[model samples]
Target: MSVKTKLRAPSTVLVLLALCLLVSVFAISGGEYQMTPWQVLKVLFGQGEGIENMVIWQWRMPRAVAALLFGAALALSGAVFQSLTRNPLGSPDIIGFSTGAYTGALITLTVLGGGFVATSLGALTGGLLTALLVYLLAWRNGTAGFRLILVGIGISSVLASFNHFLVLRAELDVAMAAAVWGAGTLNGLTWQSVTPVGILVVLVSALLLANSSQLRMLQLGDDLCRALGMRVERTKLLLVVLAVFLVAAVTSLAGPIAFVALVAPQIARRLAGSAGLQLVPTALVGALLLASSDLLAQRLFAPVQLPVGVVTVCFGGLYLIYLLNRRTTKV
Candidate 1:
């Protein structure tokens, strides 16, 4: 059975990877200035000439890479939180991480000016602090899944209201900037923007991989995991920290791009069919979802490019409603 499971998942992952690559190539080849697949290949490998090379290499490729990294990071973070809390609904956006990051970035953009590093640092601080606050508030004799989720929802509402209030109070330019960032655009993503996010995803993904076994143990409940020689509390802390950092980094880079984290893991688990959590597959699925959403954002409306977050939010919200119905029927 284990062997069959192993064989099946690799094949599925391979197929998903193939789809991701194919879709990415199509995404790269698109835009106001279209490039052929071969032109894209040539430009990527530094063998193309003049404008074609410049268009493919300088613009489209970086955006595509950004989508991939952002999607992967969102998916991984969602998967980690889902595993840690044992809740399918667990996600950065739902738990206030996105709101926290948004509030932080908004404060920086409005109060301190649009210094990139300052904004990013502020986002990180906000995300981590919010997560810590949620955890502390949720703590009891045992931190049950329901308690954490309730606390998260409560905190999310407060942070969201605060964020809106701040935006409302800001100057027009600052408020508009904050609103755009909150909408989550990947506009103007150069290679420089892509590189750091790519690196952060890789590093955080490695940490998640290292903690995978412990995460599995965590699903068995704290006392059970303790009996099984797992340091449940420590594992939970590490996973939350890693999850917060992953979401924080991406949110800082791209402004809490909505629904990717919430939707990706659920989709991946459906693909894998049964589930506690599946990391690699979720990440791949996320890359596919975000890349495809970005493609739609660019091409669907044409000249008036909608933010990728808007697209995902619409789709993911519908999907969430469906899940809720299913859960109710099952109950």
Candidate 2:
């Protein structure tokens, strides 16, 4: 990137950050017991009254923070995958990771009948196993994006059927509970619930950011990357693993919240005019999309909040239609 291009990106990031902050404030300030934006800020800084603190710090904050953090995580994963595939539709969820995670959670709930932590672990395990399976299946000579996606689709279809079967066979209470979670809401998130996974996500994100030069280099054709003496396949595999981890972590917390992952990187790349995926800006866009969507989900049907995933799915469907239309026109 040129100096001017680099400068533009940072400015774009700053603006996105500012928008995220504003949206977060708005999100925390809305609800049954609404507060002013100033009050929300005060509560965040630990200077509000009992109710404000309880509402903002205790209830609203975790959900909002989860939206921002998980959204960013999803976007970071998307950036990695899209950069690797050189396709706008290249999202981790396009593979079976999210479905695998959901299947894991379903099994845990139906068999072990475990609580949140157990369920999250189950989801993580399932996601990783699914990734391994897809990688192996796609590795004819070496992994290619189209083959990987195709394998993922098949695996996801099988896993999704298994998930439905599990849910159908389980007790009604257990099935209903699993179904709600599978719908992907930020409704009941608490600090305790979000902390461990949040920390892991931060670490994973740090690793991805640190090794991002390799991701950018991988975009320059395998032969060219090999010419530069990089272990092309190994770097690609490592980055793919890291990207999968980000998705699994997010899925563990919020179920399969879609669209944010598929859309964020493309939006960020356009906004910043980046030649390749720019991680920070993509993350910021994801954060904004999720936070804002969650806020709408909470208020759009006041007193009967919809799962945030529902809003994202609606938006995602529209995005897909637009993408298809664009591709068709070009063809």
Candidate 3:
């Protein structure tokens, strides 16, 4: 890589990181009980007193951090899937993994009466199983990206229906809880809730980054990648598994916040002008998107909060329609 390009990646990442910080501070500053950016910073640094400290540290800070972490995880997961499948549409949300994770959480909440731990396990189980099924069904002579995407879409539709059924069949209170969770809000998130997933995101993201070299090779097509001495199938499988873990981790914590994964990587790629996937930039974009959305969700209605997922769905749904229309026109 040229020195300019090398410098550009870090510089772009720095800009994104700065934006994420700015948005997070903005998010923390706004709410039912608003604070100035200066107050938020003071509270963050242990200088604020009483309610200011409680609001910023105990409540708003954790939620903002969760939003940032979840966004980064989803974005990185999307980038990995897109790279593996070579399809812009190949996201966990589009491919049924998110639906599957939702189903798992529903079962935990409704049937097992489990708490966050149970729900997290269930979500991970559901997402991994769905991915496996999609991969197996898509397998022919080999797994084609288009075929895998189609199979995932089909499975996702079915799982989505099942998820709806689960919600409906659940008892009233349980159903209500599941419905809210399905909508994907970051409300009431404490440090306890954020810690485990935060750790997982950090670890899994590091693994993905370490494998970034091999991942870029796979984007060049299997034959060429294999010619370069990469074990194409093994690498793809590992990457997909890691991607599944990342998606499940976020879904379990945030309840399938949509379209950050689907949109962030594309945004990052466009910003960086990178031919291959830009993982770090994508993660930053994801963080910024989710944190900003959460902030909007909190203050948009002022006392009455909307789910962050609702905002994402609004934007993501339009983007999906546009992508389909563009693809149709091209075809």
Candidate 4:
């Protein structure tokens, strides 16, 4: 990136940060226990009285942090998958990781009745297993991104059907609980819930961002990348593993929060005018998108806060349609 590009990128990031801050303030100040902006600031600074500080630190802070981490994780994973495949539609959900994670979580919730730790473990195992299955099935001596994506979609559909069947066979309350979990929510997020996700996001995101240069190179076809001293297949495998882990982490915690992964990188790419993964910008955009979505979900239907997943799905589905239409015209 040129000096001008570097300057412009930080400028864009500052703008996004400003937006996130504004939404976060709104989210903190406008909920059931409302507070003024001044009160919010005071609480954040640890100079406030009882209620405001408790609300800000204990409640809103965790939820906001969860939104940021989860959103960033999903977006980064999506960007990695898209760049690796050189396909805009490539994402963990598209390639079966999300479904697998969901299925795993469902099994835990249904049969095991374990706590969050157990469910998360199940999600991680499910996501990795699903990706491995897809890779094995898609492999014909070697894996091509195109064939892998096709096989993944087929496997994901099968798993999704199975998930529905499992839910249907369960008791009504259990099915509702499963359905709600699948929809994704930020309600009642605690430090306990955020710890695993936070660690996973930070670690995986750093690895992915550190490898952004290699990812950009990989985008230029496998043979060309190999000629450039890049181990094309091995790098792709690493990316797939990283992507699966990121998806598993967030989906387990947030119930496969939809569309942030699908939407954030596209928005970041347009804003940055970069052909490949704009890692930092994509992450910032993802945070902003999710934070704003959370705020909207809370305030839109007064006293009836929707899950963050619903908002992303509605917004993401429309954005995806637009992407497909645009791609068709370009073709």
Candidate 5:
């Protein structure tokens, strides 16, 4: 008789990383002129022909990489907020920060008319301001997750109207361009724009890493966290700032990618079999999700090439409905 043993599977984070890398390979291989995954790997390792190298290294690589990074950033931000608020629905999209960022962008496109730098600055400034507003409004001695969400919803509604007004008032050409960007397409992404985003991702990730312990402490309820010597309000403020920075940066670049922030953390929580959202697995899930969405956006409609946001919304909307049906508690 032979004895047989079953081995345990890999860690959820590792599995997600592997999946993310696999999706990225296919992402680089896709686009107008397709290539094989083997060819993409060769080009990645500095082999392949000039045109192949140009296509893989120069063109598609930046967009693919950006999608991965931005996805991770959004998920990390979402994890921070959800854990901080102890709310399943805590996300930038729900919290009005993304809409506020878009409002700033509309102002930049219409009023400043300045170039990329000014617009980026405008978006960042706008989101941070909105975060502050939400925090202040939600605070009645201390912020509760439910109050915060309600305030955010109200603010987002107001901003959406303002955003439309700005777009309608702008020149037709500029309005058209802004609309496309607002849709969150990765088309025409180049290394020049991607470099700064990459740097921002690194810096923000480091900040999150350093504050990770505090984040865990915060999750254990504010009174308990305070009793354990955590400066509850200060930590909350700092984490909120970091979260807003992430959402704003992604919105500035990719136009508030839908559902990556909202969905990834919750999904990762289940996959990792954890009661709370874990950052590492969540980030990987986010990377895989956004990359997969971008790939689908490219090929699903073929030459038409829908914006990445459209696919995310289509899929995310379904998830939202299912979540609602579950009757999950807000906090």
Candidate 6:
């Protein structure tokens, strides 16, 4: 790498990290019961009074942290998938994993009337199953990026239809609850609810970082990777499993919050001016995007907060349009 590129990359990542911290602080401080930065710091240090401390620690802090972690997981997952597939559109949400997760959650809610734990297990099962199916179908001689993406899109559409059917057949209250969950709000999340997911994200992210060299190798094409003594298929499978785990964990916790996985990696690549994926920068960008979006969802309409997923979908839809337009122009 060039000396200029090295310096520029680290600076960009640092800026993204700083932006994430700023957004997180804003999220903690700018809720319905507003607190200044001083009050937030006091609450963090256990110096604030009862209500302020409860509000910051019990409510906003957990939600903000969950958003950050979920975004990072999704972003890193997207980077891995995009690298594997060699397609900009390769992401969990677009490829069927998120829809599959929603299907699982819908079944738990509508059929079993399950609680949080059961619903989360169901979502994880659904997402993994969908991923396996896509992998199996996409394996011709071996998995090809374009073929995998096409098969995933088809499976995603089928799962989405089934999800709608499940929702429609459910009782009014159950359907309403399922619908709300599917929209992916971070409301009412406590530390207890987010703790397991936080741990999973941390562990999985560490593993991904450890395998970053393999990931970079795989991006160099299968023949080149094999010539370099990399087990191409094994590396691909491992990365795909890791990406699936990240997606399932976040979907279980937050009901498949969309678009971060699809957009954050591309944004990071562009910002860093890197030909290859930059996992850490992608994660930081995801954290900043989701944290800021969550803040906007809360404060945009005082008394009537929007779902974080809603805001992200709006932004992602526009991005999708832009990508399609740009692709068409190139073609």
- Estimate TM-scores for all models: 0.95, 0.96, 0.96, 0.95, 0.95, 0.96
List lDDT for all candidates, in order: 0.84, 0.88, 0.89, 0.86, 0.85, 0.88
Off by over 4 Å in 3: 1-6
Q: Once model 1 is optimally superposed onto the true structure by TM-score, how far is the C-alpha of residue 118 displaced, in angstroms?
A: 0.6
lDDT of 4 by residue, 105-207 (tens): 8888887887789999999999999988998998887777788789889999999999999899888989998888889888888988898679877998899
- Stretches off by above 4 angstroms in model 5 are 1-10, 328-331
TM-score: model 5 vs. ground truth: 0.95
Candidate 1 residue spans exceeding 4 A from truth: 2-4
Residue pairs whose backbone atoms clash in candidate 2: none
**TM-score computed on alpha carbons, candidate 6:** 0.96
Candidate 3 TM-score to native: 0.96
Model 4 has an lDDT value of: 0.86
Model 1 lDDT per residue over 226-292, tens place: 8987777777888898888888888887887877888898888878755666888899999999999
Worst 10 residues of 4 by lDDT: 269-278
lDDT of 6 by residue, 160-205 (tens): 8998899899999888877877898888888888998799889999
**Candidate 6, superposed: residue stretches over 4 Å from native:** 45-47
| Cα lDDT, model 2, residue 86 | 77
Q: Which stretches of candidate 4 lie over 4 Å from their true place?
A: 1-6
